[model samples]
Target: MSIQEARAATEQYLPGLIAELKHQGLMQLEHAEPAQLCQLFRRSNAAGLLIPQQYGGLGASPRDTINVLRAVGSLCPSLAVMMTMHHHTIATIVQLGGIIPAAEDLLRSIANNQLLLASAFAEGKPGSPIFNSSLKASAVDGGFVLRGTKKPCTMSHDMDVIVAGVACTDTGGVDHQGFAVIFAEGANITREPFWKTPILRATDSNALIFNDVFVPDEMVLLAEGANAEEIEASAQEASISGLCWFQLMVGASYLGAASALVELLVCKRGVQDTHLAQLAIELEGAHQALLGTAGTLEQRQEADAGLYSQALCSRFSVQAAIERASNLAVELLGGMSFIESEQVSYLLAASRAIGFHPISRTAAAPTLADFLRNTGSTVDAPEPAHV
Candidate 1:
């Protein structure tokens, strides 16, 4: 089906989700049970939100995907945030193409069966400073044996599949780099409880331990050579769509959370408060900027390195605006607001999540600065690390 037809069909699913969550008192429920939420997601057909149409999924366009997530976030921000990692991982795999035989099968499986693929990629690893992992892939007769721990993989407990990047030394002794996805119910994988953050309590962002896991040769996607010069050259190229799409989609989720409160303020005060009105305007601007970026990306046929900066800058902009809006919302509503409803309070906490994903404001500064100075300048990204 065409992208337009796919979008129309997907739109039919959104309002029902919003209404169902609200009806079940699941919207903004504190400490939501993960299993129940996952089941709701399954019933809603949300697992196929980004999967391709030919593979039996909705195959929503980038902008359409973000819009759906944004709508979902307006009611249930936890599910929205938890699933962002799922979309991010799949989008990156789709961008990387069929180079990884494993990724190809995994994507089709996600589409056909509506699988929840959790991210087991590295974070907080020392030295690499990127999403680079300490996992070493040893060459076996038919596949490679990988061993390492991925810090804080989102949806660790509920995911059917796990995807992560690793450093592998090939038969030639050259360090080849690629991402690996494996079904999570297998024996080689171990999930640890690590996500203790109260705000995103439902995210289940835990640790994943890989023990002598065997990844067949077909599943290892080779993207970049593991060398300083090769990495500096190709990093910006891969950064094109994978991470930019992430920033845009994730930023929208947080914006939806803050937008909920903004609507409440308007309903209560109706612009009598000039300061709150101004904040509302800023929120609108941020939302529009994100929408425009998503549209621009959806129309692109090839990855543009320049867009990396645009997407990051837009994400941080949305992040700051949501934070400001969240604070203003509380202040305008006053102590009575806190006493009457805890929604705004939880939203304020959720707004902080805009900065949790990497290429965070601090990390993106140098890359953005370099991109501004020269679009030709290569900015090494944190994920899809060559080494």
Candidate 2:
């Protein structure tokens, strides 16, 4: 099917899936049960919107994934995020060219609603300033051993597969160089509940401790070393979709939250709160901007296909979308916005959590800027065009 057709099909199935979550009372629950979001992930996987068909996924277009996620977030932000994390994991694996041969089986299981995955990065302690990973992995015997903790790992405890990011050490100066995307189960993993936010509590963002976990070579996705400039360059090029996909998902969440906020406002349309009215306008602006960016992403020129321009656009677009969602959420809800029951409060928190999600702005900006500077036409005095 065409990308547009795939998108439409996924959008068609989204509302019912969201309604199911709401019916299950998943919408009102606290943020500590990341596992509960499984229903939402299962539904998305059933739709097969995020994964490629060759790998047992529906292989829907990126636009399709964004639309479904937006609808899901409107009802339960936590569920939406869980779905995002799952796709992020699967997409990363796919982009890296079957990091594990079992990747196909895993995708099939995801499609069958038997497996779930989460991004296992972000530890409490600092290690790699870019990824902010504090976890340490030591190599031994036939496989590698991992020791360290990750904080705010979405659905870490409940995930069937935890994609842990670990730094490989070598004799050459602490290496911090080669990175491993280790695929392991949550069976032996210890989960310490750490999510303190009022929103996205269902994400169960907990601390994950790996005590000498053995990841076989097959389970290890050997990406270029983080410290090796050439390896990093290759990874950046290889993980294009992995890097940009989150932008679409983040925008979806913001748009979903904005929609919810507006719906709430519509209930009190004539309530004479000018501030709310203005907030509504701001939300509208954000919505339009998000849609515009989506269009830009979809319409990227073939000539520029290999360039990092799309990723650049996605990086900035995600940050701006999160900012807009937060701004309007605070304005429209006012003092009560902090209340968990408030319509936009959960969404606000989700946006905040995602704002600080993987690939922080500080880390993403310079890489994006370099791409734009290299590709963009020089604005230097317009080359004194012949008048």
Candidate 3:
């Protein structure tokens, strides 16, 4: 389906969201902290799109979720990126629903209140594992005390809750990799300016500092492992679902940005049919690849390394397609459009951000290679090669 069709589907799911976001004006949406766009998203109850109906969510399917993200990305890339973080965090929590205590209550609260959740799993350090947190948690009588920082935490300003990866030490001194849920109301939690990039300034991807923040025992989800490697192993398996959703949605988000540029070219008369066809083939091919992977994920009973690999493959492909499509669109749109308005340049730059997400092509190459070599073998999180 075309990007227009995707927007139509998104309208069906999140009615008037596109119009509301577009009404904010592109400059305002891109240059300022997306408070209004975020508010509009919450008002539309888009936060619950992935949550189950029982949890006060819309329970939208994977395809619908992808379409909505793509449409939103076309309008506001920052909002789409923020939504990816929120929805994937929701997806991960949902996967752990059977184990997390009072998860139902948490899900219901998020859905009903339209609360925004920000993920602080990425350390933003080269060669660092996204699942491994520099944030350390020391076991306490009732809970754990956390200390460290997570930079470039998207939606930092508007998030009601922050889910962060941490290195937790038990009373016995056994260290485990885990996730800690910290409320934004925590007195010890603070934020600093981190994202200086003008391109995605609206995302509010700032540095989140946890200064002796206390997290209740129930708020921490520790993997079933005693040490670093084992913890990573267990966490890796659990991460497949979240990673798959993240890559697919993020890829679609950037694809949507590229599609926006392509739309402009299509609107301009006298554009060559061959040039238009090339853009369509690249974009639509990537879109279908995402759809195919999403269909597979939906049919599966559970997530595995194999599906995660497929998702990554699709995401990387989409990344390439987005770059190519965006460049081609800009060239066809001519120099006047490029010099007169920031829209074309903005979309072109934003679409390129797909390459900056976690598990970069270089980081994932070794693991993917191993998986490709032995299809029966489980994919492992290899030490990322320095790029």
TM-score of each prediction: 0.86, 0.77, 0.92
Q: Model 2, 189: alpha-carbon shift in Å?
A: 2.0
| Per-candidate local distance difference test | 0.71, 0.59, 0.84
Best candidate according to TM-score: 3
- Over 1-387, each residue of candidate 1 has an lDDT whose tens digit, in order, gives 121232343457543666676676534454777766777777777877777776667777777776766666766787887668888887777765544556566777787776887866548433223346667777788877889888777777888877777777766778866666677777488878887777877777778888999977777655444554654334335535677777887887787788777766767744566776677577777877787888888787445767777888889888888888888887887778777786767777787777767765666778788877785556655686596
Q: State which candidate, 2 or 3, has the greater lDDT.
A: 3
Candidate 2 per-residue lDDT, tens place, 24-113, comes to: 653455443555566556644542456677766677565566666666666667777777777766666665553355656666666666
On lDDT, the stronger of 1 and 2 is: 1
Q: Summarize candidate 3's per-residue lDDT along 1-387 as a digit string, tens digits.
A: 478788898888888888887788656788865676568668988989999999999998888888888888888888889899999999887876765576678899999999999998876766555576779988788878999989889887788888888887666777777877888874488889988779877888899888999988888877644555654554566578888999999998888889888988888999988998899899899999998898898899468988988998999899989988998899989999999989988998899888788877877888688779887555676898998
lDDT value, candidate 3, whole model: 0.84
Q: Compute the lDDT of residue 312 as modeled in candidate 3.
A: 86
In angstroms, the error of model 1 at 177 is: 2.1
Model 2 scores a TM of 0.77
* RMSD of every prediction: 7.6, 5.2, 5.7
Q: Give per-residue lDDT, candidate 1, residue 158.
A: 85
- What's model 1's overall lDDT? 0.71
CA displacement after TM-score superposition, residue 382 of candidate 3 (Å): 32
